[model samples]
Target: MTLKKPDPSTLDLSDVDWQVSTFESGGGGNCIRFGRKGEWILISDSHNPDGPPLVFTKKELEAAILGAKDGQFDHLAGLG
Candidate 1:
């Protein structure tokens, strides 16, 4: 199924600095992410309008993404 675009206001741009990419994650979930020189945040289940946006600081997000790229996150790939 195709996901309808979510409302614009829901994106947490509080500290976002650049576009990472709008793509599907491990669980086949769709998310829009932003990346800084050394960081990124993958926004998931964004259609919901509650709770804090999942926050991943630069180093942490970088590790996760890098791990996936280098096959270190093979098991975790389908996770976030």
Candidate 2:
């Protein structure tokens, strides 16, 4: 079954439990918080909890994660 992507402006994020990695807990507020709601993955700035979040589909998020793990994004983070 395919899940419909939600409209970020219409989605209610009040009930979502956003979390940040422990490694970024002390990053001086320069990290992002992410949460999952159904098939949507939400990402928001840790410095602005009440702001609108960037939304992504489960497959999209998974691809990004896999790319990161493969060092595909390391250059963007200046790690490569």
| Error at 63, model 2, angstroms | 0.3
Global Cα RMSD, each model: 11.3, 2.0
- Tell me the number of clashing residue pairs for each predicted model: 1, 0
Best by TM-score: 2
- Residue 5, candidate 1: how far off, in angstroms? 29
Candidate 1 per-residue lDDT, tens place, 1-80, comes to: 43343344565555555443455444444445443322334443443424344555555676877877887756654644
Query: Which 10 successive residues of model 2 have the least lDDT summed?
Result: 21-30
Number of the top candidate by lDDT? 2
lDDT per residue (tens digit) for residues 1-80 in model 2: 87677778788888899888677555686688899877789999888887889999878989989999999999887799
Error of 1 at 11 (Å): 12
Weakest ten-residue segment in model 1 by summed lDDT: 35-44
As a whole number from 0 to 100, the lDDT of residue 8 in candidate 1 is: 40
TM match of model 1 to true structure: 0.40
What is the TM-score (0 to 1) of candidate 2? Answer: 0.83
